[model samples]
Target: MTTTFESAAKNIIGAGNRLDTLGLAPATAGNYSMRLADGSIAITVSGAHKGLLEKKDIMRVDASGQPLEDKKPSAETLLHTVLYEQYPEANAILHSHSVPLVVLTNYHSREKFYHLEGYELLKVFPGIKTHDVRVSVPVFDNTQDMEDLGEQVRAVLKDRPASSAFMIRAHGLYGWGRTMNEAAQVVEALEVLLSCELETLKLKKR
Candidate 1:
C-alpha cells in the first residue's frame, strides 16, 4: 500500500528518534527517507538533527531527486534516490553513522566488503534461512561527488542483487527494506554485527 506524505513524515520522525536514541544517528550525521504514495520521497531536510526532527524538517523530492519543496535535502540525497530507483521493492531507506561501523570499515580499509558469518542476526535480512551462511556487505570509499558514488553503488547492486545494506569507508551505512520497520531492523542488525566484529578484533589484539 502507498503511504501518504503525512504518514511518511510521521514514520520518518519516529525512526529518527529511535535511531538517535540508540546512538546511530548522532548529531546531524544521518538521513532518513520514505517513498511516498505518489512516488515522491519524503526525506529529512539538510542539517536537521535527526533526534529532533519535526514535520517541517521533512520535505518532498521527486524520484530523480529534484526538490518538490523549498527545503534542501541531504547532501547525499542522490544516494537515497538511486537506491529507490534500483530497488523497486524498497519503500523506506536509512543512512546512519555509528562508531562501530566507522571503526570497522576504517580498520579494514583495503577490503571492498565487510563479511558477516555465523551470526544468528543474519536471519534478519531477506532470504537467509540460517546462521551458517555468509553475507558480504559492500563498502565504498567516501566521496563528495554523488554522481560518481551513485554509479559505483549501482554497479555493485547490479552484481549483488540480494545485498540488503552497504557501508561507506570511514563514514556510515545505508540500509533499506519494504517498510520503515523492516528497514530499521536491517540497520539495527547490521549495526550489531559491526559491533560484534569490532569487539572480536579487540579480543584478538588482547
Candidate 2:
C-alpha cells in the first residue's frame, strides 16, 4: 500500500493545492510528505511555495529526514521524521502555518496544553468515536533549533498516546495519518476546529 515516487509527488502537489485553496497554506509556510514504496520519504523541498508546487519541488529523503536527492528537504523535516518514527501507521504528515492557528496560539497564555472538546469533528481523529471526548493539543514555543523543537515535540507527545496532532505556538499545526488522504483530512479537520475556537473567542469578546 506504499506509494511510488511519482504518486507521492503528485499527492504532495495536489495536497499543496488543496491546502492553499482552503487558505491553510500561505506563501511558503507549509510542508507535505508521503512515505514511498522503498520506505523513503518524498517531501516538499525547502523554500518552495506550497500553493504552486511542481514535481521538481518534491524531493526524496531518508527516514531520518536526510536528503536523498540534490534538493534540500524542508527545514522542519525532523518533525515529520520524528512522527513517522514514533507512529508506524503514519504514512504522511502535513504542517501548515494557518492564520487561525497562529493567532490562537499566540494570543493564549503560555500553558501546558490546550483542550479541544465536545466537537463532532473530533471523530475525524483516530480512536475517538463520540463528540463527548476531549483531546489535548500541545503547543510549544517556537524555536529556531529543529533538533530541540523535535525533541520537545517528542517529549510532549509521549504523554498523550491518543494525540493525532499538535500546534507550534505562534507558528502552525502539524497533522498526520495512515495515508496521504487521511492526513489531509486530519489537517483540514484541525484547521476547522481552530477556526471554530477563534470564532468562539470573538463571540466571548462581544
Candidate 3:
C-alpha cells in the first residue's frame, strides 16, 4: 500500500522518538526516511534533533536526493538514497549513532566486517529461519565527506546484495527494511546484538 507524505512524516517522527528512547539517537545524531506514494522520499531535515522531530522536520526529496520542498535535507541523505536505489522493496531507512555501534566499531581491529552468529536474535533480520545463519555487518572508515562515504558504501554493497545493514567506524549504524516498522526492528535488533558482543568482550577481558 502507498503511503502519503503526512503518514510518512508521522511514521518518521514516531520512529525517531522510539529510537531516541532506546538511546540510539543523541544530539541530532540520526536521520530517518520513508518512501512516499509518489516515488519521492520523505526524509528528516538537517539539524533537526531526531528525539524532537516534528512534521516540519520531515521533508520531501526526489530519488536523487534533491529536495522537493524548501527544507534542507540531511547531509547523509545520499546514503539513504543509495539504499533505496539498490533495494527497490525498501521503503524506510534508519541511521542512528549509538554507544554500542561506536564502541564495537572502534574496538575491532583486523576485520572489514563484524560477524554476528549463533544468536536467536539473528532471526530478527529478514530471511533467516535459524540461529545457524551468520550475518556480516560491514564497517567502513568514517569520513567527513558524505559524497565520498556514499560512494564507498555503494561500492562495498555492489556485490553483497544480501546485506541488511552497515556501520561507520567510530560513528554509527545504518539499517533499512521494506517498511518503517521493519526498518526499526532491524535497527533495534542490530543494536542489541552489538551490545551483546561488547558485553561478551568485556567478560572475556575480565
Candidate 4:
C-alpha cells in the first residue's frame, strides 16, 4: 500500500506538470486522484498549486472520500470518490479547470449538454471507432454544496456511457481512466475539444 501510494503520488505530480504547462491547472484550481491497491485513493490535498505539487501534497481517502489522515482532501473529493465507486476499473480521475471548458459551458448556459461530433479528434476517447458520430458531454450546474453538486453529477452521468468526461457549467471538467496516463490523455483531448468548440462559436457569430 505504501508503494502504491508513493507511485500514485509521483504520477499525479507528473500529470500536474503536464497539465500546468497546457494552462489547465491555473492557480490551485484542480484536483487529481488514483485508486490505491488497498481500495483507498491518493488525492491532491486542498490549496496546493497543481503545478508545484509534491509527493507530500498527496493524501489518502477511502473509496467514499473520507480522509484517512489529518491532511485535508480537495473539496471535490466526493467527486473523485464517486467516479471510483461508479466504475470499479477506473483507477485514476482528474478534474481540470481550463478556460475553454468554462467559457464554452457558460456560453451554452441553457443547454444541458455540449456536443463534440464529426471531428477526427473524437477518436481520442475510448470506444470511438470513428468520428462519424457525436458524443455528448454533460454540462452540470455549479454550486458550493459538494454533496448537492455530487448528486447532480451522479444523475447526469447515470445513463450516459461510463467514464467519459463531464463538465460543470462555468466551472470545469472531470474525466477518469483505467490508468494515470489514459486519464491525462482524456483531459488533454477534452481540453482541446472544448477549445475547438469555443472557436467554432466565435466563427458562427461572425
Candidate 5:
C-alpha cells in the first residue's frame, strides 16, 4: 500500500515523540522524514520542536529538497534527500542529537569513523545477525552547507553500501531504514550504543 501524506505525518509525529522521550530530540536539534508513496517526502518543518510537532509542522518537499508547499523545510533537508536518492529502499530517515554522540564525536574528532562491535544491540540495524561483527560508521565534519555535507556522505556511502547510519563531528547522528519503525529503532539503538561507548571511555580514564 502506498503511504498517504496523512499517514506519513502521523508516523513522523509519533516518531518525534518517541525520539524526544528517549532524549534523542533535544530542543529543536533533529529533523525527520518519510518518503511518501508518490515519491515526495513528508518532513518536519524547520525550527519545530520534535516533541511538540503538530500536523501543521509537517510539510512536503521534492526529492531534490525543494519545497512542495509554502513552508520551509529543515536546514539539513538535503541530507535526507540524498539518503533517499542513494538508497531506494530507505523510506524513513531520522537525525538525532544526544550528549553521548556529541561528546564522543568531538572527543574523537580526528577519527574518520566510529566502530561499534561486540554488542547485541548491533542486531537492531539491518543485515546484522550477530554481536561478533564490526560496523564502522562514517563521521563527517559539521557544516552549514548541506550540499557539501550531503555530497561527502553520499561519496562515503557509495563505497560502503551496507552502512545504515553516520555521525556528524560534534553534532549528532543520522540513521535510516526501509520503514519508519525500523528507522526509529536504528536511531534509538545507535544512541544507546554510543552511550555505552562513552561509559567505557569514562571507565578507562578511572
Candidate 6:
C-alpha cells in the first residue's frame, strides 16, 4: 500500500532524527523521501537541517518531481524520482554524505565500482541470505546539473541495477527500500560496513 503524506512526513522526520544521531545527515547535507499513495512524493524540503526536521519541513511533489507546494524540493529530486520510476517496489529513498562513505569513495577514486562482500551485515539488503556474496556499489563522479547527473545515475542502475545502494564518489550514498524501515536498515548497514572498511585501511597502513 502507498503511504500517506502525514505518515510519510512523520517517518521522515523521525528518520531525520535517527540519521542525525548516527552522523549521517550532518549539517543539512542529506535528503529523504517516500512515494505516496496518490503517486506524489513526500520529501524533505531543500535547505532544512535534516536533524531538526518537523512535519512542516516535509513537502510534496508529483511523480515527475514538480513541486505540489510552494516549497522547493531537494536539488536531487530527479535522482529519487528516477529510482522510483525504475523500481516500483521502492517506497523510501535516502541520500547522505557521511564521513566514512566520503573518505572511502574518495580514496578509491580510480575504481569505478566498490565491492562489498563476505560480511554478514550484507544481509541487511533484501534477497541476500548469506554472507558469502559479492555486490558492487556503482560510484559516479559528482556533478552539479541534476538532469545530467540523474540520467547518468539512471543509466548506471539500468545497465546493472544496484542491489540496495549506490555511491556518489567523494559525495555520499543513495539507498531505498520497500519501506522506511528497510531503507533505514540499508543505510545503517552500509554505514557500519563502510566504517569498518575505512578502519581496515587505516590498520593496513599501521
TM-score of each: 0.98, 0.96, 0.97, 0.96, 0.98, 0.97
Q: Write down the lDDT of every candidate, Cα atoms only.
A: 0.93, 0.89, 0.91, 0.87, 0.93, 0.90
Candidate 5 on 131-153: residue-level lDDT in tens? 99998899999999887998899
Model 1 off-target regions past 4 Å?
Answer: none
RMSD of each candidate relative to the true structure: 0.7, 1.1, 1.0, 1.6, 0.8, 1.0
Give the lDDT of residue 3 in candidate 1: 90
Give the Å error, residue 33, model 2: 0.5
Q: Write the residue-wise lDDT of candidate 3 on 1-206 in tens digits.
A: 59899999989999999999999999989899999888899999999999899898899999999999998999999999998888888999999898878888888855789899899999988888999988998889988898998888889998877778999998999999988999999999999999999999999999
Q: How would you encode candidate 1's per-residue C-alpha lDDT over 110-159 as one tens digit per residue?
A: 99988999999999999999999999999999999999999999999977
Give the Å error, residue 160, model 3. Answer: 2.1
Candidate 3 Cα outliers beyond 4 Å, as residue runs = none
Model 5 residue 106 distance off true place after TM-score fit, in angstroms: 0.8
Error of 1 at 88 (Å): 0.3
Q: What is the per-residue lDDT of model 6 for residues 1-206, given as tens digits with 9 covering 90 to 100? A: 66999999999998899899999987889999999999899999999999999988899999999999999999889999999988888999988788898899888888878899999999888888999998788888889888998898788888755467888988889889999999999999998999999999999999
Clashing pairs in 6: none
Could you give candidate 4's per-residue lDDT for residues 1-42 as a string of tens digits? 233998999999999999999999999999999999999999
How big is the RMSD of model 6?
Answer: 1.0
lDDT of 2 at 158: 74
- The alpha-carbon lDDT assigned to residue 25 of candidate 5 equals 91
lDDT of 1: 0.93
